[model samples]
Target: MKKTVKILSLFLIVLTVMISCKKDTDPADKDFFVGTYKGSVSYNKSGQSITSSDGRVTVSKIGETYSFYFGNNIPDITGVKFEKSGDNNYVSVGSGLTGITINASSLKMLVNKDGATWTADCSR
Candidate 1:
């Protein structure tokens, strides 16, 4: 009984870690997302809240910006502007989720977390 209990605890711990640390992702077959996009977002670290609702994505040859909203009643952006960087990376600066993928299309993206980046996908 004790041995079984110990194994169960270990399994639970490993499962929790696996579920919590799921951030890395590759794009699906039909995703059109690439580049680093900056959205107007600020998290209240103290309270752990999302303060902003909308952010910008790069739109085109003229360097114009478009809005990609995370809140309700707002439309997802179309014709966003994006720029390529040194190696498989891009940046569109304006708001939150600043570093997005510009080379491929997918539901998930990467956001800068200090030195490393976090993966985030668009959910529709």
Candidate 2:
């Protein structure tokens, strides 16, 4: 009986340690910065300009990267990479991309392609 008790105790201790040390992800980790945001948007191409106050941008995770779909005549941005810039902020990383910043409350985009510029300040 004592041998059985010792084995049981050892199993419980190992179980406790395994449970305590197991890696766990926070709520923020599962978020993946996916959401829809809306605000102001402006696009300028070939001397033609368009602006709107009800701009929208939807963010989603595709594989390992994020996709940005913009509204209000702004072009959609895809396959862009971002890295953590602050406590809840991320900045885009790539060439020919001026800047992209995302946070818990807002998403700002500024990119120029083929002399066309698209900018948006969105929130969710």
In candidate 1, which residue ranges exceed 4 Å CA deviation? 1-44, 50-63, 72-81, 85-90, 93-97, 107-119
- Candidate 1 lDDT, 34-119, residue by residue in tens: 23334343333333444333443332221244334334222234334455565544455544546655433322344544333333
Error of 1 at 97 (Å): 6.8
Count backbone clashes in candidate 1.
24
Candidate 2 segments exceeding 4 Å error: 1-28, 31-33
lDDT tens digits, residue span 1-124, model 2:
9999999999997875444322331113443445677899888999899898987777765445777887666677788777787687778888766488876677788888789888888876
Clashing pairs in 2: none
Per-candidate TM-score against the hidden true structure? 0.27, 0.68
lDDT of each: 0.40, 0.71
- How close is each model in CA RMSD to the real structure? 14.6, 11.9
